[model samples]
Target: MSKVVLITGGSSGIGKSIGEFLTQKGFIVYGTSRNPENYPDSQFSLLPLDVKDVKTIEKTVSTIIEKEGKIDVVINNAGAGITGPIEETPEAEIKANFETNFYGPINVIKTVLPQMRIQNSGLIINITSIAGYMGLPYRAIYSASKGALELVTEAFRMELKGFNINMTNVAPGDFATNIAAGRYHVPLNEVSPYLKPYGNTLDLMNAHVDSGSDPNMMAKAIFKIMNTKNPKVHYKVGAFMQKFSIVLKRILPDTVYEKLLMNHYKL
Candidate 1:
């Protein structure tokens, strides 16, 4: 039987690309959207699900299990992005970003694991961000949230080893996607002390997404991981430099890495 797959936040961006690619590859793919009605043209099944909401996640999982009998793979791709000076960002917004990016994915995994455990075979892929590897100016919240997920996945993988329920984190660098448009940006305050540098960094961040690699690159990377007998605990897909940045963090001293980020952002 073809493997059944479920992707959260699958209506567009990287999730949509993954869903479409898997569909073409002959997997029984189901993509979740808070508003599934918006994507009538979607190539695969688009079901209603909001990662931040447990009920919707449970319902979507049950629906998939009832229809497919087994969920062979799950991609926890539903996430929100927030950018702002750590001090200026509202507490509620920070928590909200974590809700979608961190807590949300955990909820989805918890809801589906029982079913996956029953099958005695499954794959759980968490879509993280290259930004998660380190804190970035004006994007610390997003980085922290994704980073939290990455660490948890490491622990989760070991816990699931005995059951054969594999889990991995795939961190992608900026990709040409609608994430920028959806990201919550604390308005550039005319009088705020960070107006100049934050504004510049914000513009730079958006530009990177616009010029980033095709989403299909992420799609293909994910497909390859899904096919692997033992996917690594962590994988990254992006421009060489972006992936290298992670390595730089490991080999470079803390102050040096900080300087590199400061220079890149022109802070």
Candidate 2:
């Protein structure tokens, strides 16, 4: 039987690539986007979905289950990024980031768990980031959001072990995607004096993103993980720097890591 997979935020970037890749592999792929009209008809089904909307998520899952009978995989790949210092970030902006990046995936997981538990077979992949493992300057809120997701991924992985629900978190570092261009930013009109110091920092981060690894590489890595009989709890993908970042986190003391990161960004 063809596996039925639902990917949130599948209109573009890594989500879109995953959807396309899986479709080629003979899986029935259904991708979610806030605006389905924006996506043309193709092998992958594009459904309307906004991760922030709980009611819509429930409805979408119910519809897919009714039509397809079962969902074999649910990839919580929908997320947003907000770049700036925590102090400079507005409360509402931070809350919005969490709603989309953290709570959105949590909502989808809760909605799908019952069906997955009953079937006794399923895979849940959360698209986290290297930021989840280590903090970077000017991305305080975004890092925190991914960090929360990382915790959720581990908690659910342990809890669902008995039920045979496979859970994996893919943490990609600096992929070349619309993420940098589409990142949510506060209007300059709303910027306060305190945020001025971090303007240069955000610019530098943006530049790095522009030169990051290709999104297709991350997509391929995801495909490989999905095919594994026993997927790892966490998978990191990117250029050498990203892999090294994980090693640094493991070997270096907090103080030393902080200094190294600060120097890298010239902070």
Best prediction by TM-score:
1
Q: Model 1: per-residue lDDT, tens digit, 88-122? A: 99999999999999999999999999998899999
lDDT of 1 at 125: 97
TM-scores, all models, native as reference:
0.99, 0.94
Error of 2 at 263 (Å): 1.0
Runs of candidate 1 exceeding 4 Å displacement:
none
Cα RMSD of all models vs. native, in order, equals 0.6, 1.8
Looking at model 2, which ten-residue stretch has the lowest summed lDDT? 188-197
Candidate 1 lDDT (Cα, 0 to 1): 0.95
- Model 1: ten consecutive residues of lowest lDDT: 78-87
TM-score of candidate 2 against the unseen true structure: 0.94
- Superpose all Cα atoms of candidate 1 onto the true structure and report the RMSD in Å to 1 decimal: 0.6
